[model samples]
Target: MKSLRACVAALAIATLGVLASPAAPAQAYPSPGIECYTIIDSNGNPQIHCIAVGALQEIDWCKGCPWAISFKDDIVFPETFDIDVIQGVENLSLAAAAADPRVAARFHDAAIADFASAARGLGKQTASPGPVGVYDTAHRKFVADNQSWLAAAGQDLADGLALLQKSFGSRDSAALVKAATAEFDEAFKEISGKQVIGG
Candidate 1:
């Protein structure tokens, strides 16, 4: 009878040990900081703003730190400003033109037409067909369908441009021209659904 009782106690102890083991850890969640600026239309008022991750430095939280600034509001310290990361539209135009003369000419014509149409559509906001209308065009349809791949290629071109700019400065017209050619080729390949012609 004692032996039977001892065996039962041992089994209970083993079961309790298994139950007390720690659970596996869960996956972590993304916590994005407000590092970029975006314009917001608040109550029919257009407001330019920058958001911060936390309270402002050397400022009391009780005073409402990291306050949102507006054009109508008083100027404050730690003002946010726009950084020209991609130079400007002028630079982009020149680069695009230098890269592929044919594509540049096409883009120029298309952009003018698109802008005029978009502006007209904007006047009648109800008429704006949005992405569907934009994708209706044959050229734009291909871009919409293969957006992810094209975006990756675009990023690659941007990175190459950044490298060239860093090493040779923006004055290196030759490098800029070369980078533009590469960008055009990438875009062409993406649009044509053809393998890259060369390395």
Candidate 2:
């Protein structure tokens, strides 16, 4: 019994040591199949970046400036391509999802989280209507470089999402799912054509 008690004491101390240890560092944005592209900032300083996204989320620039890009056929794109085809129907309307509180809550929370994350993932920026910040130069160059693709892709994504939202608002599950799937396919193809110019 004394030995057992001593063992317990040892275990407690071990546990305490583990608890006191520093936490693992936060993960940086991954770039498995990504490529870094550079652009000159307003101050003529070079800015390099890669896009990042989480599952079931839209693509956006990474939070911090990391310095590597290696593509493995999984290049990120700026569209709501991560929405599930069948499950995304819940986003149609709050009233429509009232019967399934779980679905409603899941989508609601996810929407909130995605919105916040997208804002952060867009990288640091000053008030757009006012004076520009450091990152603005890179952003401007990115916009100019991919002007045509951005316009086309942005319009297509907007139209597709609007159609999906409208179908949901009408409580048309069939249309909702159809629109989501179509948008998924189109976004895949549209984004695949995007390129990061090395400026």
Candidate 3:
């Protein structure tokens, strides 16, 4: 019986050690395939970074959510290509997921956590992102870089998401999804396109 008690004590200490470990180290934004971001690097050059966070419920949930881009200064576009079609939507709960409004808020809440967690996932922004309207240099470069494939407003990833919000509210986001398919299909054909996230 004393041996059994010793075993239990060992298990408890092991559990505590695992629980008290330090958090993950910091990294860059807009992980690959899962999500994308276009930015002006500190060197005055354009940088397209698409990175993926681990399946962290609190962090990754917000990182790839519908409202994710609202968190970053340089977060210009959403990777609508794989995000909606393959990876992102499976995790998110649309506001209009059900016909009942009573549950919509619950869905939205569970799918998209608050900004505090987002801040943790995105970390503090030290670099100053220059000019930022619709015609800003970063945006212009993102456009010019991907002009051949992602050229039009219809194919604009962020705009596609705007339409998506309305469609979800109406519970018929077919057009929203349809709007981006052909263009992204062509995007896949471009060089290093699987890893190249942009525009």
Candidate 4:
């Protein structure tokens, strides 16, 4: 979604550049008279434009100027409106997420619980493995201070799912789960090393 907004903004800037760009010296020679006219811009504002007045045959070619552009369609960015709507929805979600730390904490806890539940299949096909280690004191403090969600959730979620494939319904499941923590030790370290950020 962010990329989509960026592309739209870039396209709009390019279009403005096009409209503002001077069409290369339309008239090679001076004309006998000057023609002046007023045009309504995309903004519904009046724009005054004057051009060399001459007969179609008398003039070789009269490339339009930005002040008096004669393009078939007006410059318009319909996507901007869509982006505005999307941003409104995004703003609401962002505000809700930042309202408190409960959401982030819950999400982290849920992911760990999933790991703990599936961790017993490490060594044996039907054998139970050891308990999953809890977050250390430092990691718990780091998380409490963060009051935020991790943008890295996507990768973490993927890792957890991959761990499941190793531990669940596999030979020596306990070993497989242990090997996956993403091995538990690494997850513990990750939580401790994770950074705290402010909104």
Candidate 5:
């Protein structure tokens, strides 16, 4: 799942280097606005792959900027018979909170509500590997071993949400942003250590 970070980085590199082609005959660009795929695994089970390469497109739109970029290979496709991972599960909650108008407007009560929702989502077990696979044994063990750290990081995220509530109630946008950023930093640290998977 963390490999999505690599995908994002690759998307950035490709966007920076490539120039638009005109013969494709598209408005603004020739790239597809969205990309999705459906494929079958080795076990004959069907799987769908959809990558939100435009995850940050909302932010860009909010800032009055429309960046045309291709989002190819945005979703992970398993070539081997390994467990399929859900990438960016952890950050999705935070991204939702950050996108909330309450957080942007600095509304204390609404901010609390939005942040609490995100916190709750973050507190749950977000990563679970597939059940039947050759790598399942090791993957299961890896998940079991990292449970403690994952729980700790979840707690940190929840605590950070509480801090945001307090800061917002005090009407301190600077403090709120700083505290939220710090909480993210702490959560990153908690996950990036010896036991965690993604940094």
Candidate 6:
């Protein structure tokens, strides 16, 4: 009986060790407060905002990371369509152009010119009327409009990815992983309207 009890105790100890073993650190999920900003409405009402939807919570890093974005209830763009697609297109175009200089040069030049014009306009002190009849006195309105456009551009990229994955039968793990990472990076760039890091 004592031997049997000893064996049971050893088994219990083994089980406890397994349970207490450290798990691999989870992938960093987009927790709230990581990034935040605010926006104003047409009526000049200020609203607090978060890019993700729910109250941010940390999850196991080993599991897939999910992000939630939230905004004013009456936001002009719905959450589903807020991602920018044009940015992705621009990035993809630039990358392609880099590989083939001649074909990409014209597009790159046009993009640069457009960006330059906007920047120059922003640098000016006088306020100008924007498309929505809003006065761009401080250039705040101009920046916001540009930001919205970039977000739409990202959405476009996401759509492209969905289509590509569907058509290509992304069954190969390696290829699928590559494609997913690209899409995610592109989407992040579009939403943030910034250069992707570690690409």
Best by TM-score: 2
Q: What is the C-alpha local distance difference test score of each model?
A: 0.26, 0.29, 0.26, 0.28, 0.32, 0.29
Name the 10 consecutive residues with the lowest summed lDDT in model 1. 3-12
What does candidate 3's lDDT look like per residue over 53-143, in tens digits?
Answer: 2212112212222111111234322223212322222212132223345454454344232211221222232111121111133232211
Task: Write the residue-wise lDDT of candidate 5 on 1-199 in tens digits.
Answer: 3311111110111232222333622222233222222223334343333322222212221222111111122334334311111122223322322334444334333334444444334333222222110111212111112234344544454455555545544668668757765654454344334133233
**Best candidate according to lDDT:** 5
Counting clashing residue pairs in each candidate, in order, gives 0, 3, 6, 9, 0, 22
Model 4 bad stretches (over 4 Å):
1-113, 116-154, 195-199
lDDT of 3 at 38: 37
Q: Model 2 scores what on Cα lDDT?
A: 0.29
Given candidate 4, what's the lDDT at residue 115?
45
lDDT of 3 at 1: 8
- The root-mean-square deviation over C-alpha atoms between each candidate and the true structure, in angstroms, is 27.4, 20.8, 20.2, 28.2, 15.4, 23.4
Lowest-sum lDDT 10-residue window in model 2: 3-12
Model 3 misplaced regions, further than 4 Å: 1-38, 41-147, 150-159, 178-199
Give me candidate 1's TM-score against the actual structure: 0.23
Identify the runs in model 5 with alpha carbons over 4 angstroms from their true place.
Answer: 1-146, 194-199
Better of 2 and 4 by lDDT: 2
